[model samples]
Target: MVNENLATQVSRILSKHRLKINDRTLKRFLTALESINDVLTPELIEILVLDNLTIGESYFFRDRKVYNFLRKILPSKSDWTVLSIGCSRGEEVYSFSMVAKEVGANFEITGLDVSPQRIEEAKVGCYKFWSVRFLDENELESFFNKVGDKFCVKSDYRTNVTFTAGNFLSTSFDKKFDIIFARRVLLYVENEGLAIKKMYDLLQDEGLLVLGLGEYFPQVLEIFEPIAECPCVYRKIQRKEIATTAYKNVSEIRKTADFTAKPRAENANVKDESKKLKAQKEVITKTLERELNLEPALRVVEHCLENKKLIEAENFLRKLVHNFPTHYLVWKYLGILEMEKGNVRIAKEYLKKAAFLNHLDDEIWQLLRLTKGNG
Candidate 1:
């Protein structure tokens, strides 16, 4: 028997969050709701129990291929750290610990969930016999000891696992780990881009990042190269630095290398050198123009200012303002750069143009005061 109103509400919530809830699961949830209502008061139900209902179902070795890959790659005796994000009720963490033990690996397993109540329940290390319905009867019997009717996790295996409460929205980093298991968590997040970026920052260099089977984001894959494809897991690709040499210096080096060449080819070489130099100058000019062409190029200007390259950046800004005189933000940025170099007079002129274009920016008032003081 299902409560139609409750079922519809639950369905609506699931749909709002972009989660697919089958009719069967909705019916089961309705039955659970009825059972809870029978025991608990309405106020308590409204306050706590209803919002914290666990929807994700799991089993021992849920993805056999992923487990197999883990078993194959992981060393037998080494210090390894694994983070299981959105781990509900400790089942996945326990399963990981069991697998690590079987593989004879020395490891630390951490389970994180947003629900404090679920974390407390997970800390107890007890579960109902039918909770692991996906496991074989023999396997369940072997892993659990009879504590009345409920199956409790063995004590020896329970010591290595720890549970913590965490939220993905906060940008906090405590320690980097070797492997982060974020399976089935991304589907629930509002902004998948930020979540993927956060996960990238959390993982250490050469660390493995595992995701669920159906979960796929192209932007994530573009940033992180796929190492193991079948299980659809990806590892962060180590960024490589591009080698840069000054064009003039490269030409000089080439000339030195070919110093003893014949006279007839010397003319051709000189012409080539002239063409290369012209091309190099053109490139440099274009780059400078592009760097200055941005409106309110705060990031670029900041970098240049830090490196004591304000003159170069200013030169670019001057050309940029000449090309686009109406760009108020660029004028303001140019004013800031000029102020940085102690050119108060020139800075005042740029500030006036910026203020005339857009008088709303408050910082221009301060700049005007500073310029007047300098005068």
Candidate 2:
């Protein structure tokens, strides 16, 4: 059952944030609201509800194919401006940073999300082990530093990366971007046309727009053309002129790669079979890791917290802390859980432990300060 007054209030709040909530999500939102303690302020309730609605699961180098495509097409240019839409916890943004560094491109990236809490987490630039499961030892060493079982993005990667909390449709930027990554975001947007218009306006002429697999916008094909050898990637089509030498190369590559007719078949069945076996092996390994990893347990705790199931969230956090003693996030969340329960002393103690583990976390320190005031 849904409370009509509360449902209307939630709708009003979401509308003010430029977010459209459908009936299904609104129902779930109301159910989560039922677990809220009356001690919470209206502002805290708003942040909690909005944050839950915007939460997403993500990790670095999520799609290997997309990163490989980006590697090939990233022009050798200076001062490239990139925007990552719905950059949940900053993994994608840092992944792009590593790509730009490898390609020797001078680039700055901005990550935007509707959740202020997620934006704060992105600024921290620390991640759990599961987030870097795809990276090998060498890649880890190159891009991150280990701090008490947590991996922090290196100083080089963090230098030019910035994060903002706002709705993209309502937010205005002073400058346009060369590349925009809006993967799987349109699926949730209520007005697809308005969202597309916002993206179109924010992108420079002939800029790149990268989308997730299976996402398509045929109506806007006149403004954006799919690039060759790149899946789900489109280029803004305004002027019919090549902007740079690298872009000219892209055009040339597309022209030469199209042979309209089949070429002579080569007898390489054995080699192809071996490649298929290797790919299968990789998929199986990823599956096994997904099941065996503790990251999913953390996500479960997050889900519990989002639903305001404090006791359930606390139980999971305790188990996680026992198994992963050095994982500061577990401690941090425990602190937050206590704070939400109005136990300022316990919250401060838990937060102190978290802060000691990762001294660089500004959010933890801020939380500690808040707990002190509450105490």
Candidate 3:
């Protein structure tokens, strides 16, 4: 059970920052707070909980397809260094080890996690039998030695791997790596765009950054193109190189004059326009919600409208006006969505309600005239 005062404080902090904290997350927050409160005070507890909450569960060769891809593309070098960020226990780092051994590459692997206890456990390199389920009996016997109830990594393999406890937000190393495997860590960060920019700076020229199969970031995708999609991996291309490549591709297509080529440019422009509209809609909706105590229905309607989901936006706005008759902003947005949908009669009705609430705005008067003309 959580202390009610503590839970309220946590909730207030999250809400003040406009973060969405659902019931499940609140429970996790409470549990994490209780676990670390003995060693940390209230002020430091949130930071510690945030650091320890990022440990992701993994299995041996969790995604075999990604490993297969790595086997193909990883350079066969005598001295390569690989960094795995947020490597929870040792599974992914060990997976990298297995791959390196198979490719006959002499490699050093560093696995960093935020939890000191997890780092200690990883240093021991001892795991339960079930953790190696993917390995055959002979392979397991070859790679690990039985130690009491657990299996310890074989000495030959153990020397190449090191586990360190470090926070991703503040940690830095003097050396650049040939490969940085950040996997699913970025999705949980408070500022993913800034984090990606930092990661981009850490990569060597032509170096690889492998995000996990299911990981997706709109911000990262804008900059990094998919080099190999089989494993859903991305490579950090130099900005100048990407520009040069695009220029060459465009020049070639222009010379060829293929009808299929025009659509690609048009699609790029459309995507840019869509992004701008979405940003505008978010600004407007957030401002209104924060300043006016507007209904959530109106905000959802505005989002859908900005994303060009006209029918859904209209329906949502109509529902808001119907359910919350006293909310003027709901009526205002309903009118806007209706106008965008070319339904002037419904738009006029909604604009009337908005006019009743606040008659001072010139824009409202202009929209009312336009709606009346259409009706």
Candidate 4:
């Protein structure tokens, strides 16, 4: 059973993207989250969500039969554009380049994944032995160099490829592809129907779509025609549109799942900005109380100093001394402000008159001596 509080919080985030899971899954994932981090901060929560959803093991030539299927089925278009969704760690992309070359297909590949760590690794064009384990001897000889224990992809297969980190369900790249490899991704999504429709729309006319063997979506078949002898691949045939009523019912289900995720907790940047703004407000309130004079509100000025609002205090005191030249505390604080600003000569003049107001004041005495010594 999922604890109500944890379920509520996790579901809120999931629902915004039309996703949900059983309470049991949430409980186990939450336990994993707690084991990793003691505090439930927004950063930790973001890490948990992204880590769970985007993580997948990938290696070169994974499911080689799929690549062979694509090579056999390539359209005659001179330029082929392929979108590799969830191309974790870039193994698929480098592998695709080799397959495209063997079939003499002129193509460009775009790799997208939701994991920042994976996207960065993809861009680095370097891979550990684990990621290239399936590379046959000839492929190893032609496409990679053994650097220490890892393999680096030669530039020929690495060109015309780009990697970006993004959420698949929420954001869409505004482009179409002749082929979209969405293998292994739909198994993780709650709304496979929605994802399939999205991929369908992303395809060019009669374009091809492939999925992992484990993923299945019978409902979305109205838009995609399955290919013979390809267990999980589909060719985008002319639309056999669903009835309007059924489409509306699906829309309503999505709307029911839609929820507003809570805004993240107040962060350090927010707290510091709040303090700085509050200090500024206090300075304004106190400055106004003294009729903009630095005479009676020295405590407010000191409050600004204590808060390290030297810019605000200096500006206020500069204005105050300009209007009330003979005000002792006004001149005294101006001297202190200038001293902090490293203007010892100017500070000496202000301190001399402030000391004249009350020669016996120990603070004024010390300030005067400080200005003179520093000068």
Residue runs of model 2 more than 4 Å from their true location after superposition: 239-375
* CA RMSD, predictions in order: 27.5, 12.1, 20.8, 28.9
List the candidate 1 regions with Cα displacement exceeding 4 Å. Answer: 1-54, 241-375
lDDT of 2 by residue, 1-375 (tens): 776666767777777776666778778878878667455566876787667775567788766667887787666556789999888789999999998888878888999987888889999999887677556557888999999978999998887899999888888899999999988677666677788767878899888888765465543443565664554677786644323211222233344335444232311332333344344334434544443335567668878888899999988888788988877778888998998898999999999988877665667888998976654
Clashes of 1: 0
Name the 10 consecutive residues with the lowest summed lDDT in model 3: 247-256
lDDT of 4 by residue, 1-375 (tens): 435565566667666545555666667887776565547876556556666744567778766557778778664667889999888888888888877877778888998887777889889878775465445456777888777657888888877888888768777677799888888777667888888888888998788887764355555454655564554566775554324212223333344334334233423333443454344334434534443233235557777877878998987776776776766677777877778878999989888887776443356677777766555
lDDT of 1 by residue, 1-375 (tens): 577665566655554444444456556666877776656554444324223443445545555556777786777438788888778678888887777777888888898875566778789878764355435446566676767656688876787799986555553657887888887777666577777777877887777788765455655643564553233466775544112221223455456546666465654655564565455445434543443334235436546766879887787667667776776667777888888888898889989988887664556777888899664
Question: Model 3: per-residue lDDT, tens digit, 1-375?
Answer: 886767776766444323343478668778867775656565565444434444456556655666787787665656778898878777788888877787777888999876666677778888875466445456677778888767777877777899998766568888888888887777555566777777777877767777765555655544454553343465677878646444222234344344455677655554454454355335434543443323235547768978989888867766666666766567777788778878889889889987786553345677899876665
Q: Which stretches of candidate 3 lie over 4 Å from their true place?
A: 1-23, 31-52, 243-375
RMSD of 3: 20.8
Candidates ranked, most accurate by lDDT first: 2, 4, 3, 1
In the predicted model 4, the residue pairs found to clash are none
Please give the CA lDDT of all the candidate structures: 0.65, 0.74, 0.67, 0.69
Residue 19 lDDT in model 3?
A: 34
| Candidate ordering by TM-score (highest first) | 2, 4, 3, 1
